[model samples]
Target: MSIMTQLEFELEFSQSEKQIAKYILNHGEEVLSMSVKELAKETYTSPATIVRLCKKIGLEGYNDFKIKYSAELQYDLHHTDRIDVNFPFSKDDSYPMICHKLSSLYQEVIADTIKLIDFTELNKIVDLLYPHQHIDIYGSGNSLLAAMSFQHKMMRISRDVNLRILHGEQVFMSYNSNSSRIAMIISYSGETNENIQIAQTLKENNTPIIVLTSVGDNRLSHYADYILNIGSREKIFTKIAPFASQISIEYLFNVIFSCIFQKDYEQNIQNKISYDKKNDFRHPLSSPVSDEIK
Candidate 1:
């Protein structure tokens, strides 16, 4: 977890510690240059209390905390582009301004998603998915749409992916799936009741489960053999829409599809081209003159 996320989500700190955390969050760049005593004075606490807060968050001491926190702050400043994930635009904005804000939001979400990826875990997920002829995906709403998009991409490459939109069918699919099939569960909150039940059911069948979720601890992550974190800056119920979560989920799915394609690059490329040519039915005005694979 990033230091900023830990500070925002962790609730074990005392009042003073939370105050210090708030100060750091509000003035992250400023905090990067502050000494332990200076930070303590600014937060109206003692240096020892500051050190205790650092320890509580799993750092060795004030110095260690500063080192890690500074790196995270620097990365955010450079890559986040300072765009708000939850409410990227306001009512008074012009069309161009709205376009710019939405574009920046997409870029920021992708950057954040990239930072959260664990390459080792990603490799493991791709390895597990590559050998499976059929995969099962479980999600709801926007997440389900992202899964369907992924399913479409994999299908072009001669891989089968199943998704059940109805709750009863989802439950039945979970029960029927066994260890031979791999299941991917996508839940932004990572605490969705139905997703948890599916994860539990899949676990009982000894199936390997890959979970795509937001950062922080949640019930769904406990049952995952591997977890991929999406951009997590938006509120569960307060957003205009799930702009960040939806884009992040789609980007992650694209990454997974790309990685899987890379596993057998030549064959997958040929497979897609072959499928496209065989299914082509466009008129001359809309389609390429020659349907040759280049």
Candidate 2:
């Protein structure tokens, strides 16, 4: 988790710790230049209290906390253009203005999402998934749609990815899952009851879980062996649409698919090409104007 997110969402801090966290969050860039004692004095706390706050959030000390927090602050300053994820445009906006605003929203959300990605964790997920012939996915609503898209892409590469639409069927699948199978659960809020139930079932069976969720501490994250975060700028109930979450989820799935494909690049390419030739039924007019691959 990013330091900014951890500071914002972590619930175990005491009153003095919360005060220190609030001070750092409000004056992020300025804190980079100050010593631990200086920060403690400013927050009206002792240096030991500040260090304890840093360690509580998983940092080694104040300096380590500052380094990570400073990077996040800089990234936010550069990439976040104040695009409102909940309402990117107003009702009276022109079509052209709407187009531009939506486009900018997509760009900014993707940029913010990229900052949350940990390549080491992603590589571990790919390694765990690559050796499995079958995988199960669980989600609801829009998140389900994203999972279905990933299922389709993996199927094209000869992987059996299962998705059950019905709640009972999903529960049944989860109960039957074993350590041999890997399951991925997608929940934006990470608090969906059905998703939590499925995650629990999988956990009892010793199945490794991969979670795709928004950045913050949540229920679903507890069961996950690996987590991939989506852009988390949107409000759950107030958004006009799930524009940011949808795009971020799709982008993460695409990156996963592409990375897995690259693991056996030549063989996968040949397999796709061979499948295309065998399945081709298009007329000459329907073919590409310049067919270089053929």
Number of the top-ranking candidate, with TM-score as the measure:
1
Error of 2 at 119 (Å): 1.0
Model 2 worst lDDT run, 10 consecutive residues: 285-294
Residues 173-222 of candidate 2: C-alpha lDDT, one tens digit per residue:
99999999999998887777888999999999999999999876678899
The alpha-carbon root-mean-square deviation between model 2 and the true structure, to one decimal in Å, is: 6.3
Off by over 4 Å in 1: 1-81, 283-294
- What's the distance in Å from true for residue 98, model 2? 1.8
Across 13-119, the per-residue lDDT of candidate 1 in tens digits comes to 88998899889878878887888989989999999999998887668999998898777767657756487777888989999999999998898889889999999
Compute each candidate's TM-score over C-alphas: 0.73, 0.72
Clashes of 1: 0
